[model samples]
Target: MNYYECMQESINYIENKIYEEIDLNEAADRAFMSLSNYYRLFFAIVGCNVKEYIRLRRIHLAAQELLSNDCSILDTAVKYGFTSADSFSRAFKKATGLLPSIFRKQDRQYMFERVDIMEKYFEIQDLELSEKYPDIKVLKETAPFYGAAFRAESKTPENDAFIGLKAWFDKNEIGNIMPDYRVYGYDIPNSAKDDGTYGYEVVVTIPDDFQVRGEGVVKKHFEGGLYAVTETTVGEIVKAWQRFISWLDISRYEMGAHQCLEEHEVESGFLNRNFEEPENIRINLYMPVVKRNQTEYGKVIVDPVRVAYYREYGSDSEQTAHNVWKVMLNWAEKNKLDCSKCKIYMYNHGFAKVKDFWFEIMITLDFAFQDNLIKEKIFKGGKYLTYDTSLSQLVSSWMKVNQYVSANKIASGNHQWVEVWKLNNWRFPEKGIMIMYPLV
Candidate 1:
């Protein structure tokens, strides 16, 4: 079988055995490939090892059951081929951080419940894309928007929330325009929800002086900007996100801090109407991008020991690290860290490989923190490193520094500090924290 056919077969096997046993050898046989080749190809195409992928899929399924049914943890675990509750807890914790009991408890709060549908839909679809946009002309215009929005979980394109949007527009006597009129959907994180409903704002643009009724909040603004927009039919939302990612990769354009907007086009008669057919709906996805800044000349080299300091803050639990970074930056500035000669970098832990997820934050200071204030902090035994590096090479240099520290078995004692001093525009005098090793 070809690669795509083999993959499809394996996927079918996984789906059928989801509530029972999974055999790697059986999957390989079904794919008509050797075990080694299956393992390698699976990882290459899926971005995850086969075993890990199986576990992720199982966890996703268990989460859905927890939300949709009244099954106990043990029952769900057993039904899904888990040997015991403890084993299931460990796997669940690794995938979502919350234990089964905690997840059950939060079900009423609708946290897990709201995401269940999205999770299921995500499992059955391939959202990644190789390209985002072909050559398209750019257009700029200001638009007016009016609509009522509430946060609710939706997996299918056809949902009550979307239907409600159409109803609201019709009730307010708003008409749609070609190409410009669309629905802006925003995803808000770190917020509380009731019955799986969180806070969401939706805006639908209208013509001049068209005011929406119903005491719902309304706003108007200019939407003119460099937007990388793409269109997809009703069933192609997943592909659209992939296209946006591809566009970003090829164009080297950085995303600004803003919520993306989606414009939906439906038949004119469908206003405040429910339709069962998918072909009647269309969607346009827009992502905003801005130009990147060019690097300045003269860079510094940071010591490996100090790079480790930033690495530790990449953890999910490092709350105080951001404050520490601010203090270090202030010290460097007061001490005459040379902006021209040095580089400054911030790293976040838990970056998403496929979707939007990231871990902790890491900061690397090059020559910019060399003044007297920084020296005082070092003399006081503050936990930081002073390195010499230009800003442009900070990420790669830090990776190398990490490699060196790991190879040499260098210890970062209790302080665990890394930072860079800004001096003359030249990269030099990189310092790393020294640690004592435990005696065997």
Candidate 2:
């Protein structure tokens, strides 16, 4: 077995016996390694000694038990292998910065969830690409990836490439692991032969320590970098590539040093499930690109508010967005709205074409204005990473935000991307806007 699978098995064993007296030697035996090797691998992969991981995991799980059940502190400590209540409290407070008593009363997020070896070392957050919205491109950066590349030459490049990857995994008895990894590929840049065929390489993510062996497969490493990504299905992929080329032609960023990739991975968290698949699997096309100019953007936090909004659907031109603001301000004027006390924010949405888009112009409403006539929604005030920049700097600012999100491992929630004008200074408002992305 590969080291990752062995480490995973040992982690599983430790988790199953978390409540019992865990033997470090026994854990080593489970991984088929010596005690020293086990400790080394565990520390290298999990980033903590097994004992520390167990203690924190106990505190994390105990925090849950303290809130849900009426178990005494001493009983909880005994259940999780702590010798006494005092020992448990010290370890818990040291890890969570709160006493067990206080932690039970307060609700907040914790970082001591059980460690999954595969996810910790190999997983990356994929930018959930929109298959239909050809205009809304997402900027993403992948870490240096080690993959098993399966080369294929065929008239049907996509199908042949995927087949080779799956067959290799199944033959090697690792097909079950495919769901936990990513599959990406690219057509040979300039290798179209006269036989009406092309070369495509399918890449499967592998652990850095895992060595691969197969007839037509080889281990390859990529120096991952920034990519402007979009999604399309098997039938419409040709158009997707065209869209990328067209975007780069006018965009501030040009293509970069790496090959463009088409990747597929399962998407998690809040999203439109309808766009996921209809037996027509989706593909995220990534174009490696570099910025032509350098600029710095400031980061800040934005508070949420209840807002009444007017949505306008129009072309992708700036004039359409301006018209949305005009319609919103006209309605607010008719209603005698107080702009000084409230803020206005706009959220743009993409459609099937770059020329078609939709935007919502919103005004924060007070408790007294709740009864007024307009569509109202409460924005769950949460943490956000934001920047103050002009409309022309929108793409670069969002790229900065994307970098922050990925670095911080922030999870995304239902779409609430907001760009607002300066406070009550609405003159030629497009000149200045605060671009904000919600963080969860």
Candidate 3:
């Protein structure tokens, strides 16, 4: 069998005997390698030693059982291959920062999963460089980025924290887009001179209309504006980054209030031991900027849309919107219909923390979709009193706009009052909501 296939078989064997005393001899035998070779290979591709991995996996599984099942501490400990409760407690605390008893009482937002070491071995395609130089581009109202986040404690290149993220993505089948999707490395350094020793998040961008389901996952928008950009070949990333910083220093533009962005391409050459030739890798660095002579967000005139809508009632508008979109998308997928070209929208009708609120989520479908469950309506458009608002002040903002309309004696139209969402998450303080009051 090929090395990749051997690795897959080894992973399977480890998983099957996760709760048992996993023998190193048998694991190496599955990979068709000696014990030392197996250790080297595992550390290189999986990012951790085999024995450490086994312990980490056992602790992770134990966490799941403790959270979901009603078993005693000793029962859980012995069931997960631990000899004694004292040893299990110590190991669990070391693996995750939580004691088992305390972990059982809380609903953990995120958990680590088993790694699928196959991703690192796959064939990596080359990313063509347009040209190597100091380049700057102005991005206006770019789409929000959605992905998983994690903490990196140190600057050690061999740190295995990101392996869990890759494994989680693999388990969810979210890494299907290999070549097109770019993995981002976020580093908010205290001054750009810090040597990669900051808290980092390794994230993959979620595509539009794609479903994402996980905890600690968030949708964040990079403020649309001017940005200073630079590119570097894979092997000379450090030098390229330093040069980019120098370029920024000499540039006329000032830095905007956003974090640094790293776009990584060519997985084979990216900071891994599998491939050492840095010449094969390419990375794009983007830093948000404000022009010496600034700019502003321009006004947009939106036309009416005919949509099939779904309503979700709750206090949490963001969660309701997500749930409603899933229901609508699932319906479309179930009927074998294409929503690729369709525009999805959500309208917040109310937000009552103590009581139920209504959220009307909708999407425009072609005449081809004639489902009985979906109701259709046209959003009448005309001159509107447009104002930007957010989830926290949505109701208050609407009331103020209504008073303005009434005070001005502008007659109201018999159409649905529209609140177009500017950001994916309505909870975003800025650039979240655009309220449009229909006028006769």
What's the TM-score of every candidate structure? 0.33, 0.39, 0.32
What tens digits encode model 3's per-residue C-alpha lDDT throughout 1-440?
Answer: 43334667898999999877888899988986657556755764577778888888888888888888898889989988888999999999888777888877876632667886435432221122113331433333233455554334345422333554565566666645422344566542221112433345666655655565555444443334444455555456677656654444444444454445666542442224243343545556666555443522223445776777777765443466677766776775675555445555556543222234456766666565566666778754566667665654455455445544543467876656667654332223335666777665
How far does residue 43 in candidate 3 sit from its true spot (Å)?
A: 34
lDDT by residue (tens digit), candidate 1, 1-440? 22334555886786778777889899877866567656755654455677887787788878878888788999988877889999998998888878988887787322222112112211121123312233221222223234335333333323544555666666655542322344555433322222343333456655556544554445545334445556565566677666655455445343422345555543321343335665535455666544333211122332442321222222212234445455555544555655564444333321122122222223334432333323312211333323334433343234333333443455544532333334333323333222111111
lDDT of 2 by residue, 80-181 (tens): 998999999998889889988888778654567888765654323323323333343535455787889887766666566666777786676543443235
Query: What lDDT does the true structure give each of the candidates?
Result: 0.47, 0.66, 0.58
Query: What is the full ranking by TM-score, best candidate first?
Result: 2, 1, 3
Question: Residue 177, candidate 3: how far off, in angstroms?
Answer: 6.8
lDDT at residue 232 of model 3 (Cα atoms): 56
Model 2: how far is 420 from its true place, Å? 51
Off by over 4 Å in 3: 1-142, 155-161, 177-179, 190-197, 208-221, 233-235, 269-280, 295-440
- Return the candidate ranking by lDDT, descending: 2, 3, 1
**Ten-residue region with minimum lDDT total, candidate 2:** 266-275
Q: What value of lDDT does candidate 2 attain over all alpha carbons?
A: 0.66
CA shift at 73, candidate 1, in angstroms?
87
